[model samples]
Target chain A: MRQILSQFGTDCDSGAAPRTMENWYEHREMIEINIVVCIKQVPGTTEIKIDPQTNTLIREGIESIINPFDTYAVEEAVRIKERIAQQSKEGFSGPESKVIAITMGPPQAENILREAISVGVDIGVLLSDRALAGADTLATSFTLAKAIRKLEREFGKISLILCGRQTLDGDTGQVGPELAQQLNLPCLGYVIEVMEIDNKYFKLKRLMEDRYEVFRVPLPAVISVSKGINEPRVPSLRGAMRAKSAPITVWRVSDLDVKSEEVGLSGSATQVIKVFSPHIERQSEIFTGDVDTQVEKLTQKLQSLGVV
Target chain B: MDYFLSDEQKMIVDIARKIAQEKIVPVRKELDEKEEFPHEIIKEIARADLFALFVPEEYGGLGGRIFDVCLAVEELSKGCLGVATSYAASGLGFLPIIISGSEEQKKKYLSDLASGKKLAAFGLTEPDAGSDASAIRTSAVLDGDEYVLNGTKQWISNGGEADIYTIFAMTDKTKGARGASTFIVEKGTPGFSFGKKEEKLGIRASVTRELIFENCRIPRENLISREGMGFIIAMRTLDKARPAVGAQAVGVAQAALDESIKFAKTRHQFGVSISSFQSIQHMLADMATQIEAARALVYAAAKMIDSGAKEISAASSMAKLFASDVAMKVTIDAVQIFGGYGYMREYPVEKMMRDAKITQIYEGTNQIQRNIIASHLLKSA
Candidate 1:
């Protein structure tokens, strides 16, 4: 099904002639800055089963949900768009903004993109291809970076990119920084609050292991946020209805200027050899007779174990 | 059990359920305890376009579908009947205008109501009138280009909190019920005011108060329909709104049953889960069955109304009457199953039980619903 859509790639992949300087000048007048949020569809259940041979979670049977942390990212992106749009409402014709969410997974992953739209996302982009399966953080970030560049070319200047700090199942907090590295853009992770933002810079507060660090980062940067940044809104009825019929922009590997060797699993620098659930064992001993006897027995055992 | 809902219907249910579970459920207990209005939650509902469900698409709504409205109401009712009442009562207030208003009225008022930019209330019952709605003494006398309204409308849902009110008043005292007329009254109109908010036995999150009009002046254009059509409009509005009440009952009952089942499974006595006991099992089975039956009836009644059939009085009343009784019984049974825990404020079944009673009493008491049904039955005879 996705193969048919990949053939008629929408928006940016027309492969048309590069616009002349005149066209760029005309388009630059609007100054429509786009906000891109990267999301993933992960298992919605805790009963996840790992495929030992493939070292991946089996996707069948389980319900898919937007990675929990990603919801906060989507909320923040929508909020930024809303804030910018408010200025437009207040008669500031500085620039119009749109929140475009992009996800890379199976065609079924399009559900998450629609879910994103149901809560005020303007557009959704799906990067689906069979070859993109079994990707490590490196390949995932590389492919996402390519998708981001493609989005930037089509949607105009992307002022900020937002992503969840990490995916639930993967729990590897590398994609945001790696994608930023791939794009040669500044990146910040673990952002708790956005204090302020203007055309050029963002004042951000980030919670670390023990203290808080604030940064005034430049625009055109990628930032991954932890949960609790903001509460994601429930889908509005109109938004849900809109999402039901809204067109999902599909991007194939061919849609991007990407080599087959550097676009999917083959693009990764590392691979998982094995996956297993960690087993925990607990041993208990019951001491009888009296409280003193039990205490003495416990102390003797603790002493034998070299605790004192 | 699958209801085999259409994709659109499923979407409506899913969205409402998300709001109910994620937004309403967490704060419902506190709201009930404080007797405070669910203002933030109502704003959330408005933001979600729930207020637009039963309005026409031309008026910035999804579409006028009573069935779709019922689906949303039921899900929300499961979270908190008080919050659901606040949401559904707005729809109730819109019924008069949607059913019988002029084009100018629809164009002027519906857009705001449909977009949830404003809330509305229906004022029909008076201090002396409940089941005998025609006994209302509120009078709207035509004076020059405006109608001067006087008298108090008691127990109005949404009351002062709503921006718009569809008020029923007597245009001719000698004509009795036939002399009634309905008019649109904005909240801050001259000589219009609200009495103190009423304390309620249940559904505490919804605001209710008396609408007092002391020679309140409204333009003649605010009249909903011709004089003497007030009774018909009120009856029709109630009929159209009955399914939603039925849905509310089903929702509250379903919540009670859910609490019962959840509690029963974990609650242990005599070395076993209470759910294993025959008495508890039978009660659960009965509660589940009655709820499904009520749901099916509510769905059918709403569908019949939305099919543009005007002769839906019997069906709508039956849906409301049966479902409310079932809600009352089921909630009582749920509390019984929970034993002592159910009666405590810490648990939810007592609140469900409290909320369920109003469904039977309001929207025309169950006795009135039965009378309407019986009249329809005998008329067919």
Candidate 2:
């Protein structure tokens, strides 16, 4: 019975019933699982202005915050880790899981990573380098994938990769899929819920245009979560203090062993040729009459507009 | 104008403001109407590690200073002074331990208090002890390894809800103020009970009950500092905490001013916004100026206390006195700006006015604060 139960959750379970402590030890190895969550810090305010000349954002005085959508992804990852821990406590014998938050931006991006730690992320990694500036989505995804690979090398196997469907600043909704391609893993987009997980496979609920679909995929997959997945928790004071003192591992282009050219603007496959705000045109008409006459006029107007 | 907060302090302010806006604001009115303790909000605050702000990190705290606590209190008070009082009053109860507890005592008590696992209350006020704390009639007599205490502490915040209490009693009545001693008593101790809760004009969300100790026995080791040090400890604690009350006052005052400005801008009379009237503008100007001055004084006093200044009695008293007065005046002006609407309970300024009055009364009345300031000035002269 124990052997049958073991196969349901563990990879090291052999087809043998353990009769001694030594035999039990030989049958299983304590699985270590790490979840990598991607986060981005965007300007706090929506009243952004683009420099007409440089075609760049005016970020000199604006406050920055973790991308709002990304917070949902981070929250979902923490929730999944917590669930796994709870299951472990209930004799599930699941792997010990840790949520690791990763970000690629200026050195100040470490602030978002610190925030992630303050809200239950176990580790934080910042991919910061002057050379990585001006990268488009493709190059950005490559750099992040390289950083994830570096994290894996240091912290052992990563069981899951999570990201927000899109960032507020970029809103491209492309990085998650591109990173999934770069890492050669099965990718699921618009994930709204995590149904179940074990050592070998996991189940996720992906949202579609008009409905939701559940899918079971193998371990070590990439999942891009939507904003509706979960409500993020506020950082506890103890968590904040811990994050204040927590050591964030800062990795540069050199640290990831990636070619400098492929990581920054030089490796980008796309560039913005022009940027401008679209002008909106408006027109209005007023009908002056009694209520019945006004209703007749509105009907005639709608009919003239091909309404019937 | 040159007041600068550290990055950590700024982060604390941001977190506290978020809590006030997101968590406290929604339930503030209901809590006041129901006269309910904000248990969930307090838990949230504790989870955020705010309770540990003034606690040293060595004792499982964030190791923040009095300035940090003032910043947090001000932000929370902006949402509701009643809820803020519950938070600030806990800090008041724990200050004696932080200020005078021995290493062993600190280790035993400060850790849980800092972690917010247990709420604490200060028991110094009685029917006869208001303003004149030296007149407390509570008595504590030594018997074997324990001290038997008998007293009724009135109008104590967090009275029945708190788990630990720092109570003062006269050990030798012949010595007057010097006869008193402070002791740490747990809630479950036999003969320790609470009296009827008081219905108040404002800050109604906070519990104000009588702490009745009838032959309450506690370990002699529970005595903080030494015999006859209760008065000194109480005074020192109040001096440090007075600015926190000032911060609370500033918060309520600022809230009232903000409401008035918004109301004035939207309210119209004779085809023009009331805000466009020079008379209303002048009232707003005076309110804003006084509030700024009060805030400056409160922050300066808090900073001085955090800087370990020994002679801050005058500054603390001044901060409390000026800020509480400004709170009352500003709130009243805010009501006037609202006209008849402000007089109605439907508006918030009236509630603010009620809350502001307590700041003047509690933690040593404004009158007592004036006395303290004058005594310090005369002594210095």
Who wins the TM-score comparison? 1
What is the alpha-carbon lDDT for the whole of candidate 1?
0.90
TM-scores for all candidates? 0.91, 0.81
Best by lDDT: 1
Q: Give the alpha carbon lDDT tens digit for every residue of B1-381 in model 1.
A: 677889888888998999999999999999999999888888888888888897999877889899999999999999999999988999999889999999999999898887788999999999899999999999999999999999999999899889999999999989999999999999889999999999999999999999999989999999988988899899999999999999999999999999999999999999999999999999999999999999999999999998999789999999999999999999999999999999899999999999899999988999999999999999999
Estimate, for each residue in B1-381, the C-alpha lDDT of model 2 and write its tens digit.
456888788878888888888888878878888999999889888878889986988988877588889999999999999989998888899999999999999899888888888999989999998988999999999999999999899999999999989999999999999999999999999999999999999998899999999999999999999999999999999999999999999999999999999999999999999999999999999999999999999999988988888999999999999999999999999999999999998888888888889999999999999999999999999
TM-score for predicted model 2 compared with the true structure:
0.81
Each model's DockQ?
0.64, 0.39
User: Which docking category, incorrect, acceptable, medium or high, applies to candidate 1?
Assistant: medium
**Residue B107, model 2, lDDT:** 90
RMSD of each: 7.8, 5.2
Clashes of each: 0, 2
